[model samples]
Target: MKISMTVNGKPVSAEVEARTLLVTFIRENLRLTGTHVGCDTSQCGACTIHLNGRAVKSCNILAMQAEGADIVTIEGLAKADGTLHPMQEAFREHHGLQCGFCTPGMVMSAVDLVKNHPNPSEETIRAELDGNLCRCTGYHNIVKAVKAASAKM
Candidate 1:
């Protein structure tokens, strides 16, 4: 199948198998490696990306499902001048990551979370992050980062 989409502000098209995952297309065809493929079964939110402005796990969907969609990977969160997004900067300032393997997904999810709940409470942040798992950093700083970024975003 042939899939076309706007990824990270660029229009992209490629021939992909029906079974090709969106994460695979982003990381392989487009060479955007920030969207990690951890737990391909979708148990981990490591492959999360913005599909049409909403964060979704890329590993959970076929590439064709994103045809003509607007997608944003972790690499797209930064400005063209190399300035980090507010959420990303908050994560770094708060030390929200340890292994950094799950940072991209966490940031993506946090961005969506703040979008829906501009003034989310601690409980809301925790509840919203139920899908994402981190083996390190018990989520203290992650929550803090989300809260801090909310003010700026």
Candidate 2:
């Protein structure tokens, strides 16, 4: 199938198999590997990406389903001059990430969470982060980062 979509503010079109996962399309075809594929089953939110202004696990979505969608991977969050998003900055400042394997997805999820709840409490942050799992950190800093970003965003 030939699918066209806006990815990272650019128009992108490619031929993909019907069974090709959105994560594979983004990582392999589009060469945006920041959206990790930690688990192909979608249990982990490591493949999270914004599809048409909402976050979804790319591993659980088909490339064709995103045909006309506006996609934003972790790479798209930064400004053209490379200014990190507030959430990204908060993650760095709060040390939300440890090994960095889950940082991209965690950051993506945090962006959506803060967008939805601009004034989230620690409990709200924890509830919103239910999908994303970070084995390295116990989520102390991640929660703090989200709380900080909620104030900024």
Candidate 3:
């Protein structure tokens, strides 16, 4: 099957198998390695990306399902000159990541949350981020990063 979509602000098309997961297509076919595949199951949001401007776990969807859609990975969030996105900056400043395995998805999801709730409380942030699992950071600094990014926005 051939899938075509806008990815990271660029139009992309590729031939993929029917069973190809969106994450595999992004990381393997598109060579966008920033979207990590931490878990094959959808429990981990390590492969999360914005599907039509909303966050969705790429591991849970087929590449064919993403055809004709707009997808934004962590690589697309930075400025053209390579400056970090506000959420990325906040994560760096607040030490939100330890092993860095979950940083890409965490930052992407945080950006989405802040967009939906510009001034989310700590509790709300925690609730919204419940689906994203991070084994290294314990989520303390992650929540703080979201708050800091919210303030900047």
Candidate 4:
């Protein structure tokens, strides 16, 4: 099957198998490797990306499902001039990541969370991050990053 979509602000099209997952298309076809495939079963949010305007687990959907959709991966969060998004900067400043495997998904999810809750509380941040898991940190720093980024965003 052939599908077309706007990825990272660029119009893109590709030939993909019907069973090809969105994560495969993004990472393999597009070569945007920042979106990791931690768990193909969608238990881990490592494959999270913004589909249209909402964050979704890329491994959970087929490539064809994103046809004509607007998608944004971790790479898209940065400015063309290389300025990091506030959420990304917060993650770095607060050391929100360890092992770095889950960082992309965590940052992506945090962007969406802040969009929904501009000034999310610690409890809200914790509740919102329920889907994204980190085996490294205790989430104290991640929560702080999200809270700090909320103020900027």
Candidate 5:
């Protein structure tokens, strides 16, 4: 199947198998390896990405399903000048990640969370993050980072 989509602010097209997951298309086809596939079963949100301005688990959808959709991987979250997104900076400033494996999806999810809730409380942040799992940091700093980023965002 030939899939065409806007990725990381660039229009791209590639030939992919029907069974190819969106995560594979992003990581293997597009070479945007920042979107991790921590759990192929979709239990983990490591493959989360923005699908048309909304966050979705890339691993849960087929590459063809994303046809012509606007996609944004973690690599595209920053500005062209190389400035980190406010959420990324908050993750760094608050030490939100430890192993870094789940940081990308976590950051993406947080960005969506804040978009829906500009002033999310700690409990709201925790609840909204139910889909994303992080083995490290115990979510203490992660929650803090989300709150911090919400203020800046």
Candidate 6:
């Protein structure tokens, strides 16, 4: 199958197998390994990415489903000049990640949440992020990072 999409800000086109997962296409075909695949069953949000500005678990979607969509991964969150996004800076400042496996998804989800609710309360942040699991930070710092990012936004 031939897939065409805008990834990270660059237009990309590739012929892929019908069975190829979106995560596999991103990491293998496009060489964007920042989107991790912790669980292929979609239980883990490690493979999250932005599809048309909304966060989705790439592991659950086939590459063909993403054809012609606008996709954004962790690698695309930074400014073209290399400066980190406010969320990325907040995560770093607040120590939101430990093992770093869940950071990409967490950041992606955080970006979406903040976009919708720029001043989200702690409880709202927690409830919104219930789907994305972080085994390392105990979620305390992750919440702080979201709050911090929200303030910046």
Give the TM-score of each candidate: 0.98, 0.98, 0.97, 0.98, 0.98, 0.97
lDDT of 3 by residue, 1-153 (tens): 878999999999998899999999999998999998988799889988999999999999999999999999999999999999989999999999999999899999889999999899999999999879998855999999999999997
Please write out the lDDT profile of model 2 over residues 1-153, one tens digit for every residue. Answer: 899999999999999899999999999999998999897888779999999999899999999999899999999999999999999999999988889888899999989988888898899889889999887865999999889888888
lDDT of 4 at 57: 98
Across 71-151, the per-residue lDDT of candidate 5 in tens digits comes to: 999999999999999999999999999999999999999999999999999999999998899977459999999999999
lDDT for residue 85 in candidate 2, whole number 0-100: 94
Global Cα lDDT for candidate 1: 0.94
Across 22-126, the per-residue lDDT of candidate 6 in tens digits comes to 999999999999999987888878898999999999999999999899999999999999999999999999999898989999999899999998799999999
Q: Point out where model 3 deviates above 4 Å.
A: none
Write down the lDDT that model 5 would get.
0.93
| Clash count for each candidate, listed in order shown | 0, 0, 0, 0, 0, 0
The digit string of per-residue lDDT tens for model 1 on 18-127 reads: 99989999999999999998888887899999999999999999999999999999999999999999999999999999999999999999999999999899999999
Tell me the TM-score of model 4.
0.98
Give the range where candidate 3 is weakest over 10 consecutive residues by summed lDDT. Answer: 129-138
lDDT of each: 0.94, 0.92, 0.93, 0.94, 0.93, 0.93
lDDT of 4: 0.94
Model 5: lowest-lDDT 10 consecutive positions: 130-139
Question: CA lDDT of 122 in candidate 5?
Answer: 95
